[model samples]
Target: MTTSDIDESVRAELDRLRSSIDNIDAAVVHMLAERFKCTQQVGHLKAQHHLPPADPAREARQIARLRQLAESAKLDPAFAEKLLNFIIAEVIRHHEQIADQPGERP
Candidate 1:
């Protein structure tokens, strides 16, 4: 193929890959939002029960479960662990914020 033709092919493939990534990003954002919502509810429940804000043991369990799932899916366990850790941290922080707010019960 001519140089221009090869360049066009590569560009097309890159565009396709980008589109897929965009979809994945959207899904991740949606799932994170859902996670935060659930965590907020949990925070409320914990507040009502007069429990502490952080649940280190539960968080560790969740990380372990996520790591297992990633392994089963044939993905990189380390990458999965890191990503889940980040997400979990964010969720926990949001939960704590919700719990600490004066007006809210959780």
Candidate 2:
């Protein structure tokens, strides 16, 4: 169990896997940044048009779509839905703050 006891090959394999995981984590963060940029634009557009911050119908559709995609990807659908819901909540919060500002024009 200890690092000192593990075989050299096993240590190398663990290092390789950890490196790949680190790379994947970085990519996920970058992708999330891009996603938020798009959602920021959406928030501005909604704020400009006097629209509601949260769209339940669209959210439902998105959850369903993501669930299907999760199934296709062999990921847990419930976990994907939960993650999307959390992201949607954050996006809605951002939209609400954008809507509150009166002077900024989108």
Predictions: Cα RMSD each: 3.0, 1.3
Segments in model 2 whose C-alpha atoms lie over 4 Å from true places? none
Q: Compute each candidate's TM-score over C-alphas.
A: 0.81, 0.95
Candidate 2 per-residue C-alpha lDDT over 1-105 given as tens digits, one digit per residue, 9 for 90 to 100: 788999999999999999999999999999999999999999999988889999999999999999999999999999999999999999999999998998645
lDDT of 1: 0.82
Query: What is the C-alpha lDDT profile of model 1 across 6-101, one tens digit per residue?
Result: 777798998899999999999988987887788878888887677777788988898889889999999988899899788777776776777788
- Lowest summed lDDT across 10 adjacent residues in model 2 is found at 97-106
Candidate 2 lDDT: 0.95
Error of 1 at 86 (Å): 1.9
